[model samples]
Target: MREDAESLDIRDVTANWVNAAVLDAQIKERIKSLADLAHTPLFFGRLDYLHDVGAEQAEGAEGESFYIGRRHVHDAQGDPMVIDWRAPVSQPFYQASRKNPLDVRLRRRFGYTSGELTAYEDERLSDPAEAADGEHTSRLLQAEIERPRVGPMRDIVATIQPEQDEIVRSELGGTVCVQGGPGTGKTAVGLHRVAYLLYAHRERLARTGTLVIGPNASFLHYIEQVLPALGELEVKQATVESLVTSDAVPVRGTDPAPTAVVKGDARMAEVLRRALRSHVSPPAEPLMVVRGSRRWRVPAYELEEMVRELLDRDIRYGAARDALPQRIAHAVLVRMEQAGEAPDDRVQDAVARNPAVKAAVKAVWPPVDPAKLVLRLLSDARFLAEHAEGLLTADEQQAVLWAKPPRSVKSAAWSAADAVLIDEANDLVSRTHSLGHVVLDEAQDLSPMQYRAVGRRCSTGSATVLGDLAQGTTPWATTSWEQALLHLGKPEALVEELTAGFRVPREVIAYASRLLPSIAPGLAEVRSVRESPGSLSVREVTTDTGTLAGPVGAADGGTGAHGGTTADAAAAAAGDAAVLDACRQALKHEGSTGLIAADARVPALAAALGAAGMPYLSPGEETTAESRLTLVPASLAKGLEYDYVVLDEPSAIVAGEPDERTGLRRLYVALTRAVSGLAVLHTTPLPAALAGAPTA
Candidate 1:
């Protein structure tokens, strides 16, 4: 059981601290109050969401609000309101990059601060006809208003505390930092602020005039639905990678410049092939098409998913589902990524999402079979045997090595994205740092130097960085507060921190705070200082793969062939059979249990007991992360949280940058993933990193 959880035995409300019924009653009351206020609030103004509460506009579209206008805003005193900063002159969000603002928008989201908004007075944008937007709202009325089909702009609204919002709004400088932990609802609230700012400044930029840069392809699709649900439409959305070269991979100097395009329609075609059948418009869910084109006959609504389907499937060919639509559809954009592709944004995201297509294209072109080449190198122990020298001449070795990208990078949707979201902000970019607006969802994991690297991307010393800095789990490159503040390069006024957490219980704030490490003046005391109601405990599970004695449990007893336990027992059984003896001492859970492991994968003979399965927000699958028997590789599980982690690798390895230490920081990254308990499963003795797992 989680120490912070109010109860462990209850099935319905597994996340709350109290009983399900009791919690539901309280939630119902709260939601009812919100719903009622939504229906007939005394004030008619749309909720003007601050980045937190204090002052300025948030950068992303998700944070933009439905603006009723200056005449509509009311001071706390209930008098007509006005912003004084813009009196003499205003700045515009649109700067040098006007030809393709969406392109620039991608940069801004990732950390590109150069694209400053040239703010303007409100009157300049108010002249459009009401009917031009196809919606009618009387500016004079004080009554609540419902936007075009978009129902409620925001429902599950997680935002920074009021004070933090003030800090974010108040300053606009070269650099800013938001350091916090995972599950803090940083992404959710940041998006809300985007929508809020846009809506509030509707006169400044209409839906068509604005753009929102998001993390990656799947991340965009995962949360993209939020804004449209609130009645907003036509805002441009994309990723930094996509925006830069239209999601095209730039080969520094290629003889024939093989395939410059990695995203867009050509890419979308590959994605669609992988997804659903060729059925476009299902009039029943009719928002996808403004009008169908002669070249394509199927329903337009199917277009986005078509791209998603095709790409997801294609990438799995050593590639990787959208369901009940919310009646909202991704707007069709003309293609601009590939040479022959039209101006279609939807296609851009699709192609970027499917890396398999690019790899396949590269694989097939020039007619060389990677399998053959790989086989040849891998054949007589040349590839498999690490120490064998003179496997081939230096040039030949270089040719074989230069074949393609890492499978992980190829499979990622970053290529076609317009912005980048580094969920584990502290992780590296080596190449990704170039993408604009690198929004680090979890600011807490980052060290000061990483902050500066990300901050520099802004060109304006601006990037959307968020993390709690509580867990000193990993070493940060930046050492002093003076260094952090100096490296950030922005006035202290511009920095912001979010204190509200939508994920953890109020009780959890206390214990989780201990995770943050020491920081310079920048984050000296931004630990988990908030009070919380959650509890904590750790459990130890040990099983020796070599000493199992008999065939009671198979060599690799995991669920692939033995996935027959009830949800609860399957998790426990997996943990029991997989953890290391010494490491077993570290876990302490109260109820259902949270088993933290070096990684999510189970060990040999420790299959049924390992907590494996990557629980992340893939498009249309945010809630799909249930506790399953997943063979998670420790390297990939870094910075994530799970109830249980089965570190089942018989002999987990960590190589340095050159040697096969796996990804350099991967081992450490995986170790810090657990929020509650941790377990290590192995056949032999333990590794050095986990020497402390031994229990009483």
Candidate 2:
């Protein structure tokens, strides 16, 4: 496949330089897509149909047999050697069952070790004997699901479950919201859906574009390579903040939880709309345009009527402003025609550019700078009060108001919420560019305004919203997927919940689900398929060691303070030691190990790890064999998984949040990150909800 793509001679195929350049780029992309990756098999599964399936069949074949892979591969004679997973014929590979064979006689799953096929399992879907017995579980599928995760996230095309394949293959015209719990492959499903959509509608999506929105830079970095690995390189990825941030309003500061919540409320959208419309004023003077040896006059009342008509139309702010000049020019043209003079569109356009007409348009409809408008709305109390009179209460208005407004937009300390506000105002002035499709991951953490910002990007297209409601840790976390979809402009979107676990072991997920009743009462608990005993361990440190002999403050560039009592210092040292021991034990395993701790406890843990001669990487850093340990802060642990995890002080993780429920959600996220095993160490008592959970 690679040789065929590379051998294509496009140098003399085009007649012009532009065509040649475009062809060259396309050829290069095709060559890249065909490049063979080391250890990644060309195909992972095969399907044997009951009879000859299609018009194009293998030479001398009785029943059609097709190999399923990530990308399509063909021989020199244009005969398919491997079929793309997104192909319609390959649907039965994932969805075929004993009860419903779908004409698939045999479904074979391949297991690979270091990219070489080591084992294969077959299920006779069409066999009546097997159908009468019961369902058949493939050992290869379970092994693939329980495989130790090492570095960044990988594509799940080969391991996609029937439920996940349905979501991935959904039509591109409608939006989908997946309320999947931890380890349900929601992230992978969202990504594979993009690959599938691009396959089914390549030319359309290529022209319209696609994007994947993650929660933060770390999560985006972790999953950055999944698409490329699946032969998709055109899709873009970004965070909500990055999508909204512009040069005029870069996020340089943060808002208090209360303030950010108010700024991110859905009401802020209406407030921004009202504030922006306030810039338009009724024209009090008449407009006079002097043409060649002729004077065209428009009455003030007539001009007022034009402005009123434009406002009533409720088009985009900039669109209406652009049309206002033409309206005035048309009025002048009417007078010209009434005077027995002939006029054309060119003449009307020329008149619209007239200084008198331009000045009149400016007076009635001035240009609005989105950033400056937002600045004024946040800075000027009277202006904000006028726009937010009924939308925001006085207390809510004060909460969002800047204590010290900067003199200029560039100089202002814009928060993330403020950037979203500017984005809204920008859309009010002009329409945001729409993409063909968008995948929003970790969506529960997004604010309403943030959802609006994302929805604007795909207002004319569609979206795949993926998140776990139980993992919402933000103060403005979405209360329901229904409300979230409404904010996203996709109120009619289909919502699906996935409760089956595939990554975290059964014991670990069961332990983590203890907090579900406290954090998300209405959500169902995840039913893990893999039952691995001794996968979850909770250790409470009771023994105290002496204080650290070295200065612990050096870890965070703080002065060493040894002012605590002997017992306090000893207990702190002992807790640190226990966490270190847990990490060491986790590192003894074969895959990546993560030491997750609360934001407040990171410095001390870092000092402990350094003193113990343990080298570790921060979140988002690529994990290597020699350095497979990553010290993840509780806040950044979402959307990240490890083979083994050593979680420190669940109580501290809970306390890091603004409220108890959100805190418990954060703790739930931290607890569920383990793929192979989990060892939780805590010196303090567990939360009431987790107190009754099984411990080691």
**RMSD per model, one decimal:** 22.5, 2.7
Q: How much is the lDDT of residue 605 in candidate 2?
A: 81
User: Candidate 1, residue 89: CA error in Å?
Assistant: 24
lDDT against the true structure, per candidate, is 0.33, 0.88
Q: What lDDT tens digits, residue by residue, belong to model 2 across residues 1-696?
A: 678767878765888889989998999998887777777898999999998776333322234788889887778787788888888888999999998999999999999998988999989899999899889668999888877777788889889999999999999999999999999999999999999999899999999999999999999999998898889999999999999998767899999999999999999999998888888999898888999898988999999999899889989999999999999999888889999989999999999999989888888999999999999999999999999998999999999888988999999999999999999998999999999999999999999999999999999999999999999999999979999999999999999989888898999998998998999997999999878899999977775353333222222332223356665566667777778888888888888999988887788788888899999999888545558899998999999999999988787787778899999999999999999999988766788989887888
- lDDT, candidate 1, 77-119, per-residue tens: 5443422211111112212122322211111111111222222
For every model shown, the clashing-pair count is 136, 0
Off by over 4 Å in 1: 1-160, 167-176, 205-218, 229-463, 467-493, 498-502, 505-534, 543-620, 623-696
